[model samples]
Target: MTKQPAHIVVAGGGYVGLYTAHRLQRRLRRELGRGTVRITVISPEPYMTYQPFLPEAAAGSISPRHVVVPLRRVLAKCRFVPGAVTAVDTEGHTVSVRTVAGEEAGGEPLRIAYDELVLAPGSISRTLPVPGLAEHGIGFKTVEEAIGLRNHVLEQLDIASSTRDSAVRSAALTFVFVGGGYAGVEALAELEDMGRYACRYYHNIRPEEQKWMLVEATDRILPEVGEEMGRYAQRELRGRNIDIRLGTRLESCEDRTAVLSDGSRHPARTLVWTAGVKPHPVLAACGVPLDDRGRVRCTTTLRVEGVDHVWSAGDAAAVPDLTAPPADPPALCAPNAQHAVRQARRLADNIAAAVRGRPAADYRHRNAGSVASLGLHKGVARIYGRRLKGFPAWLLHRAYHLSRVPTFNRKARVLAEWTLAGLFRREIVSLGSLEHPRAEFELAAGSRRHPEDT
Candidate 1:
């Protein structure tokens, strides 16, 4: 006889959903002895990308595969449905999702019913109205973008080294990164390190000739690392001949001319938009209460106001931080990996209590501090107010994240990759075709078309 599935749907299998599922497994292993509670995760992606290492991936410090955790493998007990949840029908107790082939492609829609729903759709690349930006600029968010940027940059090096045309060469060599935040700084730093090393292989190109600029609208960078570390980073980057512009916004990308709000202009081929991100729009669609910023409003217990069967956390939901009694979660928990992992655990525990009809626990955590790898052994770290700069911080950053990188197999592989990279030079080969989904489609269509006059 067929039995009903005791389903719990978790939307968006990034850090929050994936970890929450893992926690549920741990918490329910004994409960499952009685045969009850099933968990399913729905999202466009079948994996959770450890995004903090994206810069290193782009710089060839680590293999791309090492930075992402396959959701199906990690969440072995949970049903994995790869799709984008477009809407939620609270009355129907169901969610709508677009059953796509993958995150990189668009696909058909599907309706899914659920007993309990947890939305953790995560954020997208937050962009602005800068001219020609969309056509020319790239973001440093996903694995694809990191790989694409790496390939594009390496291809640029090849183009510059091979071409004698000055304008083309200049455009090919120039790389501009917009944003001074962690993503922008780390990516630019790592890529610049790669570029500098690559220049040695080019007979015509001088190390000093290549242009790189980091344009930040703010006066400083790495706000989380505090002022001292931020200043130190600026000095280190400047010593490496990296042009760091403060108080400037990228006004235009039209005509391949980079214009600044400060009235400066330069021609560059590469533009990386890593300004910041916003909460996913799915929070508003769930018909739950929301804050002014569209984040799901939750009390300290991580419960959605007036919604009995729903709970929220991570970048998608605004759960109050009781630790910050006087403040509102240090500005929505800064939307990073650290908070997401913690929030996922708390949410899991809270959800378990809700299911068993028990008092829920409150979410409260202190700031553990921030760490960023500048390039290679160069890094900055602030651990609970103690400031660190250079290699020591780099070690801490590696040790800390390596411990939190999900699976033991991946953790070992990542360590091995790091060890090998230190001994050998970077693999700077470009695999740009990874971005084009229809490279063969044109050939297929062209072959089918009537033979040309040729």
Candidate 2:
């Protein structure tokens, strides 16, 4: 008699989910061939977004296509389910998911049963209680936003350079970025560099004419690269005539006018929200034990506390960092890609151990330092108690991520793209029409006289 295969369901295809599934596939290769375990990954997206490269993709440094790995190709052994898990029935070991394509029909949620489950749903953007943020600020997490910001910024240059209306031009030329972490810092720096380079092609626009402002509630920027590197980054940014305002808050924004707590107001059309992210609300619906911060409370071994056959990792899991001194390693892994990758691997190992009736190992990872790309040939990096800045830091930043980006095919393609980009100029064509393809049709229909006027 043949033994039944165990169904292992993994939620979310982000860094954590993808890496976990990757490791699971490799570790369970023999088990899979023997029909001992079946791994199924569920996510709304079929591609695993390499989020760290979003800024570069926005700045046209790296091709956007190369930043995302097709999950189907990467995890051929796993069953890829395309949808978001809406609910979890821990007692029954089943998850309720809604297919993203089902919204049009008001379809019912589909349920899938699993023998073992891994929760890695990741997180959503954490917006502050500020006025006009929802209306004015664009998020920088997804590839769509990155490329959209690039298009919008470049379009702003076109508007400012061609228009004689000072008010319109002023609003168009001003760019404001909120938050000072790696996302905000790298995004502001990269887009500014792209815009500055783009201005060379505009006959009427000077790079200096465009105003750029970075507002951080904290006192510094690029906290991931440590304090000294943060200081150096600020200095370099300021040297480029970019405005870096710390200890400031966004008060409100009325229409295109942004007002700051420091009593500064500017008519800016661009506002990027890169403040931070909180755990996905799905965790709450899962009815699992949560930490004070709402993350799934987990043991050092990555198993959900008080829940049998359930595990969690990544930003969504508040698993204790054993390396931190009774505290949180001076930080709870900083919620970066580095930690997520390592945690996923450890999480997978522990899951495999649990299934085999072996001891589940603890998840302990020492920080290997951090890096941030600040436009072309500019960045900040820290490695093994050593810090680097300027061009060398940027090179290190690229090299490190290139190695981490999944798959040899993608790595080679990215390197080829980088080599070509260094020799040529960035491709700045805007595909904003994709977001609203029927706008023209609607406008034309509204303008027509219902076929009465020939």
Which of the numbered candidates is closest to the native, going by highest lDDT?
A: 2
Rate residue 249 of model 1 by lDDT. Answer: 97
Cα lDDT, all candidates: 0.85, 0.89
lDDT of 1: 0.85
Residues 357-438 of candidate 2 have per-residue lDDT tens digits of 7898888987799999888899999998899999999999999999999999989999998999989878766667767889
How would you encode candidate 1's per-residue C-alpha lDDT over 258-304 as one tens digit per residue?
Answer: 89998988888888899988888767677888888778877777777
How much is 242 displaced in model 1, in angstroms?
0.7
